[model samples]
Target chain A: MIRKGMIILVLVTLMAPCVFAQRVHIDIQAQSFKKFKIAMPAYTGQSDLAASLWSSCAKALRVSGVFDVLDPRGYITTAALAEIAPGTLKDWSLIGADYVVTGAASSSAGNVSMTFQVIDLSTSRKILNAQYTTQQGSAYRAVHAFVDALLESSLGIEPLFKTKIVAIREEEGRKQLYVCWPDGTGGQTIRGGGNLVLNPAWSPDGKKIAFVSYWRNNPDLYLLDVASNKVRLISGLQGINSAPSFDQTGNHIACTLSIDGRPELYLIDLATSGRVRLTDSWATDTSPSLCPGGNDLVFCSSRAGSPQIYHMEFSSKKVRRLTFEGGYNTEPACSPKGGLIAFTHLASDRQFHIALIRTDGSSMRVLPGSGRGDESPTFSPDGRLVAFASFDGDLYVSDLMGVAPVKITEGGGFQEPSWSNVMK
Target chain B: MKIGYRGFVVVLVVSVMFLVTGCAKKAVAPPEVEVTPPVVETPKVTTEMDMAEMVDPEVEARRILDQEMAEFENRDISFEFDKFNLTPEARKILAEKASFLNANPGVNILIEGHCDERGTREYNLALGDRRANSAKDYLVFLGIRPDRISTISYGKERPLDPASNEEAWAKNRRANFVILNK
Candidate 1:
């Protein structure tokens, strides 16, 4: 067995160089004060694949969270570009373009050849170039791959263009839940459109949805059967039930209930309808997240006299406080790998932002500025990103609401985003 | 002066009518009050006959609730800050209550789970369940059948005391017994 493993390792080590060469390259300055601006001219072809490619290159670059794409229509006249190339670069430079993307598409046997080039506008030199063949609808995938390579050449970090988002979509005045691919494809709804729902949570299996719904006329935690479309009330027996989470066991749920008339943490046994209370404070205890081991749970508690996250162990029933630095913290969500806990942290100004703290509660760092009320944050499956719902207005826009999240979903009004676990 | 006199006459007539009727009804109703008092007392006696009904069913419920609340007020379940397990003292109290339940099978008790208002709402709920179940399991082991006892975890919803303190939290993190449906 050791010999076989050695042989496989040897082959893998030998082939690693070739794999690295094929990977996309991203290039950003190690130190730069200004952002990179890129210009994209429409791909030329008569086929639908060409049109898809033309739209995708711009979309991919825009979604990269980098690169301000110069508007061709704003610069070059449509009538002029339709008849003549008109030297599109001249107009782009007049508006201060640092990089340019030029592409041409051709179709044969139902596959498209999307050849694209990245040029450094400053040096007037070609930075990188590539061509790909892909099916019609998936032409965007090819374009994004090329853009990824271009981004690597311009920026040091990789772009999250391919990552997807999970959101609660409001449909026809009712709240429904949905998961959309990064490019907004494969939209699937987790809850029915007509039900009143809040805070949908995804279990590690990625198959079940744990959310608060008024299906029973009062707030109750319901576990939705993703495939069978069946819904069962999980931990609900009077007084303000909400916020359910799953431990590694998958059979039990960690939820908040107000049976005692104040919100607190409770564990529910799926088999026997038994419940156990975990905290006994006169403050609110909510947002329960089970760590990777299934035995330890991290939750937000006002026990410290303010809302903060705390870690609890099952065997010893020992509780240690987790968050101490923040004035107020709530809605704790543990990452899939159990490294970080994402939560909503309130600033001294009463502004809310998504913050990440070490599981040990040592390094509590808030993500760089977002609009006010950036509450209900959750982690992506890979633990690479966090999604939260927030208002776009300045910190003072208490009057303005109902704006959709920046770029995660097509339809707006998403709050309490719970990233789904890895899908099989 | 003429209007005032007319009003005075109306008042005199109303007062006389009320006095006559009141006296006549009082004179005739001694038997009904005599007969009704014992009859009403009998049903109230039955409702209060059971230990669970020691007070007015609703009033008794409120009173029993108030009386049992002293247990939570007096006892404190200590957790580090966010934990759900019972400590040695907590177990000792649970064991004592379990013994009480074992001594009396006729009493049906609800083990109310509680939390110290400190954590996230959902996690505290699971913690509350663990705390309540920890007590329930102890009772079952003490010879109380699981069927005889039903565990209901209230999570962090209910508080024995409204004060937000270590004192209040220690009080809230408890498994309380009440004659719920019994």
Candidate 2:
């Protein structure tokens, strides 16, 4: 038995070179916002299941706005029949494909397993090879997981495909909060049966959502736990209690409260329910968005005679105005990186548009869009996309460099969209 | 002697006629003077009751309160574009309302602050709060009890007019009053 094992090991070592020679190397920097050309050849086993998984993976990558999936009709005829190893690299490179992803699936009993490899066509080197197993009906998730692995391996960034957007949808005059995948699928209503609901915000952990609803004839703040599907009222002050934003610590929430006869910013300790006033101005101050470190906050205030963005330090309570060019700049959403703020700016054309500015009050530019009421701008966790609601009540996602927005939500009456952080 | 007797009879008849006419004039003159005094005194008593019925204090208080509420509802104090400071006209209206509120100490009111649909909802909510409180502060300064007046902000959700034109926006950017109790 020892002699037989030694002979098998020698054979494996000889074959390993052939497998390594098959991979092509791909430069990581070649991947950009520009669509990367990817060729997805068919999987080896379970032809029908492999086809479906490949389609799902391609669709996910395409919807991510990162890949230009080549048409299958242009694929070399032998690309599908060829093995997933280096043998297929020649055919994919001939088609000018930058990257080639191939996989195989096998099912036994009630569980299914999938293995996929991402090959860099330029250097013939394998960049990613991952295997995942799931229940028979969860093949799509397995494929998505593989795609996420590929993205991370190539770009060194987390994939946003699995993230969800929580927004308010008004149906038949009753506003309900709904959560859906960023691609606008798998939507389910999370909260409803209120006179109106607005401003849904996601916590850093993505386990709880904070929003304002008019449940008891008054606008009250609520915290919804996504796991247990339970909601608890966070603030039900006598006056306007709305716009609850969770700080980075996840232990406190910053919200607007008018109980003192004027709407001002207040910080609520989530654990103790203790409240501390942040802004003590007779003028309007609300929509407090905490920066990444939770040490500073950017909000909209009317102290300058019109709604404009203002920055405030958490400890010293020192306030500085951040927006000046536009008189109607509001809804300040600080980026996760702590250097930029996205807001809704009312332009000279009397239309609301999405605009961005540096946190220090410099480098302001309006995102290009023709929508009249492009409002409530929220940044993606990576600060690459800005999701906002338009006049038609449709949620749109646009890049920071002002690309044409891609409409994510189909039906109307959708507003106050908040993108969740990367979910574990 | 006979001519003297005839002259005496004629003189006696003239004296008797004069005495009867004088007695009739004296009787009518006393009654005219007496009736004039009582007729003048009767209206003096009726005038007091008529004055009371015309202006009953409780009914007048309610009517005035109702009138003030109607005025408050119809005459919503408008602000300049994106402003909460009371305009001259707004202060004048608040002064008039303050007087009514002072007179009717048992009345309670609610100030509903509103804004145009131009700003963010949350910011507008704060602005509306400021607008409502501005009005309430003026009223309180004019001697109305602070507890008697409550404030609420509708933000830009509840607009007086839903149109997007300047006219509608000007009308919507206001602080309205609602009487809670009287």
Cα RMSDs of all predictions? 16.4, 24.8
- Record all residue pairs in model 2 with backbone atoms less than 3 Å apart, i.e. clashing: A22-A86, A23-A124, A23-A125, A24-A123, A24-A124, A24-A125, A25-A123, A25-A124, A25-A125
What tens-digit string does per-residue lDDT give for candidate 2 at B1-182? 89999999999999999999989888784444444454454534443455546777898977976777787667789998778899999999899888878777988988988999877777787788789989999999999989998888778878889898899999999999888874
On the 0 to 100 scale, the lDDT of residue B104 in model 1 is 52
Q: Quote the positional error of residue B144 for candidate 1 in Å.
A: 32
A1-424: candidate 1 lDDT, tens digit per residue:
2222111111001111111122224323112323468767666676465566676667656545456678777655332121123355576677788876777777777666666766676656666666766665455656756765675565544444344455566666566666654444445666462366766776667667778765654557787766566678786576557777887767788888877746778888877879999877766678788888787888887777667788888888888888776677888888776777887777655577677778888877766445545766766554544666664311110101112223444435555566665455
Best by TM-score: 2
Model 2: docking quality category: acceptable
Model 1 stretches with alpha carbons more than 4 Å out? A1-41, A46-164, A183-194, A248-251, A269-276, A392-406, B1-182
Q: Write the per-residue lDDT of candidate 2 for residues A49-117, one digit (tens) a residue.
A: 877777777766664555668998899854453235557578888898988877787888876777777
Among the numbered candidates, top DockQ falls to: 2
